[model samples]
Target: MRSAAPAPRVIAVVGPTAAGKSDLGVFLAQQLGGEVVNADSMQLYRGMDIGTAKLTLGERGGVPHHLLDIWDVTEPANVATYQQLARAEIDRLLAQGRTPVLVGGSGLYVRGAIDVLEFPGTDPEVRARLEGELEEHGPGALHARLAAADPEAARAILPGNGRRIVRALEVIEITGRPFTANLPSHESVYDTVQIGVDVGRPELDERITVRVDRMWEAGLIDEVRALEERGLREGRTASRALGYQQILDAFAGECTEGEARAETVRATKRFARRQDSWFRRDPRVHWLSGAMEDRAELPRQALALVERAVTA
Candidate 1:
C-alpha cells in the first residue's frame, strides 16, 4: 500500500475526447480510495448520457461519481455553478479522508474546480442585447465582433456556440475587461495533481469516428428525439452539444441523418484538437500515453505520478 501524503490532494484526469479519461478516472479513484467529482460540463445535463459518453452504472464499478446528471436539458450550463458544486464534492470527499478524482475534457470546468477562478458576473441588459444580436445575426456575426474585442477569447471559443459567444461579450461589456481576464493563471485552490491522457491525433480521430458510429448504433437519434420531447431544442446550451446539435439539424431537415453523423465525427475531431490545445497550455498537467500499447500501464504510471507528488 502507498503511504498517505501529508494532506489530501485532488487528482484530475484530463484530455481530449475519446482519450480514455473517464476510465482512467475510475481506475485512479478506486486505487486511491476516492470518489469522482465530474468536470465534464455536458454530462451535467440529464438525458445526455450516450452522447456525452457517460459511464454506465455497472461500468462505474460501484465507485461514487458526483455531479453527473444534475441539470435538466433545458437549463443552461454555468461553469461557475459547476465550480461550486465540484469543489463542494471534492471538499466533502477530502473531509471523509478520501481523495477527489476530477475527470473530463471540459477544460474550464476542470480548472474552475481546482484553480482559483472567479467568473465575472453577468449584466442582464448587456446579455439580452448581445443575445438579441446573436439571434438576429447569428453567432457568426457576434464572433466577428468578439474577434475584434478579444481575439484570444474568440479564437478559444467556437463561433457556432452562440451561448458562450454571448456570454463572452457580456462579460467584456460588464467588466470593461477581456472575457479571458476571468481565468486564473494556473493558481490551484487545492493541492492538486493533473494527469492528462495523451492520445495521438490520428488515433483520437479514429476513436471519435468509432464512438460516433457507436452512438448511432446505441440509439443517439432516439435519445435526441426523447430530449427534444423534453425541450432540448429550446435549450441554449444543451441543444448545442456536439452530437445532439447535429441530430437536431437533421431533425430540422437541415441535413440528412447520415450527413449529420458524418458532421458529428468531423466536428468532434475539431473539438478534440481544441481540448488538446487548451490543456497543453497548462504547465501543471503531467501527460501519460493512452496509446494502445501503453494503455495497460497508464493506471500504474498515473499512480506513480500521484505517489511522487504525495511523497515529494
Candidate 2:
C-alpha cells in the first residue's frame, strides 16, 4: 500500500536555451544516482538531434536519459501525452530510489511533467480540422483567429507557431473555453528543487548565435534533409521546430540557405528570451548564473539545493 504523497525529490534544471542546462543536468544526475528526464518539447522528436542540441549518447556521460527521441518528426506533439510518459518514468525511477533530473527550457513541458496541472481534453476531429485550416491558411490566419477567440493565448504563443495556434483553436472549439484557462497557476506534483540557469542578454545572445553556427557546422542541413524523407514536413510540431522550420522554409524556396541560417539565430534568441520569461514567472525556481565563468560551479551549487530540498 502506498500513500498519495509523491516521493520527496525531483531536481529540475530549467532556464533559457544555451544556458548550460544539459551539462549541468548530467552532472547532477551523475552525482545523485539519477537519470535525466527530458523536459524539452523539441527533443521528443527523433532525428532532431543537432538543431535541438540533443545530447549525443557520448555526451550523456553514461547516465540514462528518458523521454527523448520518442516521437517521429512527423508526429504532432501533445503535452498531455508527454506528461503521462514523464510521470511514469519519474515514478519508475523513484521506486528504484533514483533521482530524476528533469532538464530543458520548455516551460509548459516542465509544468506538465511535475506540476498539478490538468490539460483540457482533446478532440481528434476538432484538432484535425483546425490543423487542416492551419495548413491551408497558414499560421498568420489561424493566429489572427486565435487572437479574436482568446487574445491572452495569442499574446503568449508566437504568431509564426502554426502548430500551437492550431492547438489553441482546437481547445477553444472542444472546450468552448479560453485556452489560457487550462494553464497551471501553481501546484506541484513532486517535491522539487527547481534551478533556473541565468545569463546576461549579451552573453546569451552570443551563445545562441554560436550554437546555431555549430549546428550548421555539425550537418544540421543534412539532418533536416534526412528527416524530410521521413515526413518531417508533414509533422506539425516537428516541422515548426526553430532551426528546422527555417531550413525547411529555405528548401521550400521561401528563403536562401544563408537567410535560413540568419533567421535561425534570430528566432533562437527570441525563443530563449521567451523561455527565460516563462521560468522567471515561477517563484519556486532558485536562480543560478549559467555564464561561462560561473558554469564550473553550477553543479556543486545545484546539488546543494537538491540536498536542501530534501531536508526542507
Candidate 3:
C-alpha cells in the first residue's frame, strides 16, 4: 500500500494596510504556482467592495483566490468558520499541486487560521441577548463590561470593535467560559513561513492618505449610499466598515463630505498603526522596511525566506 503524502504547508503574507500584501500575493502565487486565500474579515462580505479594498478579478492577475466575498452581509463570519474553510481550501489546492498563500491585514484572522484558535460555537438566545444589549446599553458600555469580565481578552481585542467585543462577551456568557479559554494552547495548525512587509511610518502614512483619497474619488460615498438604501445601517456588518461609517455619517448630515474624507483617512491610518503594533509583537515574522528600496525585490526576498523555511 502507498503511504499518504504529507499535507501541504502554508505561506502567509501578512502586514499592515497599503503594505502591498495583495499585489505581493498575486506576484508570489504566479511565481510559486500557488492560490491566494483571503484572511481579511471585511473582504469576506459580498458588496462591501470599495471600503474593504477587495480585489477585483482583473487585479487578481488570473490567479485563483478563495474565501473572499463568500458570505452574505447578514451572516456572522467568525474566526472559527474561517479556519475551517481556509484549511479545507488549502487542502484542495495542495491536492491540485498548488501552494496556498494567505494574504491580509486582519491580524486576528491570520492568527486564528495559523494558530487553530477554537472559538465557542454560537447560541441563538445568547446572541439575541447580546444584540439587545448592544442596542440598549451601547457597544462601549458592553465592552467595558467585558473588560471587567475578561481583562486579557479585552486587552487583546479592540475596545472600539463592537462586533468582536460583543461576540467575545457573548461567548463567555453562553459557554460559561472566557473567550481566551476556548483557544488552543499555543499550537499552530500549519508549518507557516511568515513574510511581513513594512514601510517607514511617514511613507506608510502617505500611502494611506493617497489610497483613501483615491477611494473617495472612486465613488466610495456612492457605494455607502447604495448600501444604506439597501437597509444596511448602523449596527449592521456592512455599515461598520471604515469608509462606510464615515460616509453614512455624512449622508445623515452628521458631517460634510470633506469631513467624512478626513475621518476616513484618519481611521485608516489608525487601523494601519494598530496592524503594525499587532504584527510587531510576533517574533516569528521577518520584517522588511524602507520604501527607498526596490519594491519588486521585496517579494523576491520574501520568497527566498519562505523557500528556506520550507526546506529547513
Candidate 4:
C-alpha cells in the first residue's frame, strides 16, 4: 500500500524591511505553486499600500496572495485574529496540495501565524485607565513605567509607540506579570521553515533610504492624505505606522516635508536594525543573502532548503 504524501510545510520569508522579503516571497510562491499569506502588520490595512511597500499584482507574478489589505485603517491590529486567519489559509493550502508562503517583516505577526502563542484577555477598565494615562502623560511617561515593569518589553517597543505601550501596560495589569513574561517560549504551531533574507547593515540602510525615497516619489503622501479623510488619525495603529506617522507630523505643521522625509529614512534604518536583531535570535531561520548580485540564486537556494526540510 502506498503511504500518503506528507503535507507541505509553511514557508515564511522574513527579515528587516526593504531586505527583499516581498520579492523573495513571490518568487518562492511562484516556484512552489503556493499562495502568499501576509505577515506584514501594516500591509494588512487598506489604503496603506505605498508606505507598506505592498507588492503590486503585476509584481506578484500572477501568484495568488492572501491577507493583504484585509483590515480597515480604523481597526486596531489584533495578532490573535491574524493568527486564526493565517492558520486557516495555511491549512486550506496544505489540504489542497499547495504550499503556503508566509511573508513579511512584522516579527510578532509572523510569530503569531506559526508560533504556539496565546494572548491574554483584555480588561476594559484596566485598558481604559491605561489609555487615559497614555493620553494625559504621553507615551514617553508610560514607556518609562514599562521600563520599570518590563525593561525587555520597553526595549522591544518604541517609546513613541503609545498604542503598544498602553497595550503592554494593560496586559501587565491584567495578567499580573510583565508583558514579556506572558509570551510563550520558542514553540511553533505549524511545521514552518523560516527563510531570513540577510543583507549587510550598510546595504540594508541604503536600501531602506531608497525604498523610502521611492515611497515618497510614488505618492505615499497622497495615499496618506486619502486615508486621513477616512479617519486615519483616529485609527491608533494606522496613525502610528512609521512612514505614515512622519507624514502626519508634516501634515500638522510639525515638520517640513523634507524633514519628514529625512526622518523617515533615519527611523526606517533604526527599525531595520531592530528587525535584524529580532530574527537573528531565532535559530530555525535559514539565512540567505539578499544582495543584488545574489538575486538570481536566492529562489533556487530557498527551494533547495525547503526540499531538504521536507525530506528530512
Candidate 5:
C-alpha cells in the first residue's frame, strides 16, 4: 500500500538536560499530530522511571511514544539495535501519514538513528576478549586500550564510560578497523529539522538541582531499592543512570542521603554540559534559547520550521 520512496520529513528535538526538550516534544506531537520517539539511552529501560524523568501517561497526553521501554535492563542496547528499531518505527509512522518526532538529550542515539552511521554487528568472541580484559584490568584499562586502538572514539568516550569503551574494543576487534572509522562518511538518513534548546549555565545548574530534588520526592530512591530487589545492580543498565547511581550509593550506606543527592545533582550538571557539547557539533540544529520569555512559543516555532521543511 506504500510507495517505494523515502518519507517526507522527521524533526529531532535535541539539547542539554533540563532544557525542556521533552516538554517541547510533547507539545509539538500534540500540535502537529506527530508521535514521539525516544532517543535518550537511559530512558529505554522499563523500571528506571524517576531518574530518567520518563513521561507519565498524563504527560504524554495520549500521544503514542515509540521505543521508550522496549528493552530490559539485562539486555545490551547498542546503536545498531537502536537504529534498526527506530527506522522501523519511523517507517511505520510515515506509512500512517503521521510525523515522527525524535526527541532526547542523547546525541549519539540521535545521530545513529537519523544519520547514515553503520555500526558493525557485534562479535561475541570479541566481546568475550574485552570482558576478559575488563576483569583483569578494569574499565579504565579497557578505555586505554580503546584510546590506543581508536583515538577518535576514545575522545568521544570518557574513560569511566565502560559501556562505550567495551563497545569500541569489541568493534575494533571484530571488524579489524578502528571503531570511529565505521561512522557515516556523508549525509544523514532523515530529512530532519534539528532543534536545540539552549539554557544558560546558572539556570541550567539550578534546574538540575530542582529536578534531582523532584526525583527524590517522587520516590526515585525507592525505585532504586525496588530495582535492586529485582537484582538490577551497579553494572546493570538501570543502575548506571545518574540519579540511580547516587541513590544506590545511599542505599548501600556508601554515602549519606544529602551527600548522594548533592553528587547526583553535580553529575547531572556535568552530563548536561557534555550533552550540549555533543549537540553543538551538529550545525543543522537551530538553537532556541530556553530563557525565552514565552516558553510556550518554542513549540510553535518548531512546528513552523518543520512545516516548511516538509512542504519544501
Candidate 6:
C-alpha cells in the first residue's frame, strides 16, 4: 500500500507594521490554496479599517480572510477568545485539506493560535481590585508595582497598557507565581511554519511614516469619528490604539490635527520596534527580506521556506 501523505501545515506571516505581511499573506494563501486568518488585534474590531490597514475586498484578491472585523468597536480585546476562534478556523481549514495562513503583527495572538499555551483563569474580585487601582493611580503606578513583582512580565507589557498590567497582577495573585512562569514553553499545538518579513530600521521607519500619512489621507479621522459614535471611546482596547488614540485626543481639543498626525507616525514607529523585538525572540520563524528592491522575490522566498519546513 502507498504511504499516507503528511498532514498539511499551517503558515504564519508575521513582522512589524508596514513590512508587507498582509500582501505576502494573500500571496501565500493564493499559492497554497489556503484561507487567511487574521491575528492583528486592532483589525479584529469592526470599522477600524484605514487605521489598522485592513485589506479591502479587492486587495484580498478573492482569497477568503477569516476573523477580520468580527468584533464591535465597544468590545474589549481578548486574546484568549481570539485563540479559540483562530483555532476553530484553522481546524476547519485543515479538515478540508486546505492550509490556513495565519497573519498579523500581534505576537501573542499568533502564539495563542498555534502554541500549547494556556491562559490563566481570571478572578473577578482580583480583577476589580487591580482595575480600581489602575483607575485610582494610573497604569504607570501599577506597572511599577508589577515591575517590582515580575520584572520580566513588566518588560513584555507596555506601561500604558493598564488592562494587560491588571491581567498580569491578577494572574500573580491567583496562581501565587510569576506571570511569565505561567507562559508555555516553545511547544506548538499545530505544525506551523512562521515567516517573518524582514525590513531594516531605516526603511521600516520610512514605511511607517508613509503609511501613517496615507491613513490620514484616506480619512482615518473620519473612521475614528464613526467609531467614536459607536462608543469607541468606551472600549478599553480600541480607545488606546495608536492612531485612534492620537486622533481622539485631537477631537477632544488636546492637540491640533497636524500634531495628532505627527504623533501617530511617531507612536507607530515605536510600536513597530516593539513588534520587531517580540518576533525576533522567537526561534522558529524564518526571516525573509521585505526590502522594496526585493519585494518581487518575497513570496517566492517565503514559499520555499515553507516547503523546506514542511518537508524537513
Best by lDDT: 6
Report how far residue 4 has shifted in candidate 1, in Å.
Answer: 6.9
Better of 4 and 5 by lDDT: 4
| Tens-digit lDDT track of model 3 for 62-144 | 99899987876666556777888988887798778788889998887888878867677788888888878888887789889
Instruction: Please give each candidate's TM-score.
Output: 0.97, 0.93, 0.90, 0.95, 0.92, 0.96
Worst 10 residues of 3 by lDDT: 1-10
For residues 1-312, write the lDDT of model 2, one tens digit per residue: 211223247989999999999999998888888899999999999889999999999999999999999998878788899999999999999989988999999899999999999888878888888878887888999999999999999999989887778878888888889999988877999888899999999999999999999999999999999999999998878888899999999999999999999999998999899999999889999999888898788877777767766767
Positional deviation of residue 31's Cα in model 5 after best superposition, in angstroms: 1.7
Query: Cα RMSD for candidate 4?
Result: 2.9
Clash statistics: count for each candidate: 0, 0, 0, 0, 0, 0
For candidate 3, the lDDT comes to: 0.81
For residues 1-312, write the lDDT of model 1, one tens digit per residue. Answer: 443544248899999999999999988888889888888899999999999999999999889999999999999889889988898898898889898999999999998999988988887888889988988999999999999999999998988888888998888888899988886788999999999999998888999999999999999999999999999999889998999999999999999999999999999999999999999999999999999889999988988888888888
Give the Cα lDDT of each candidate.
Answer: 0.91, 0.89, 0.81, 0.89, 0.82, 0.92
Clashes counted in candidate 1 amount to 0
Q: Rank the candidates by TM-score, best first.
A: 1, 6, 4, 2, 5, 3
How much does candidate 6 score in TM-score?
0.96
> How close to the true structure is residue 128 of candidate 4, measured as C-alpha lDDT?
90
lDDT of 1 at 224: 100
How would you encode candidate 4's per-residue C-alpha lDDT over 166-238 as one tens digit per residue? Answer: 9999998888899998776689888888999999998888898899999999999999999999999889799
Name the runs in model 2 displaced over 4 angstroms: 1-8, 135-137
lDDT, model 2: 0.89
Q: Could you tell me which residue pairs clash in candidate 3?
A: none
Off by over 4 Å in 6: 1-8
Weakest lDDT window of 10 consecutive positions for candidate 2: 1-10
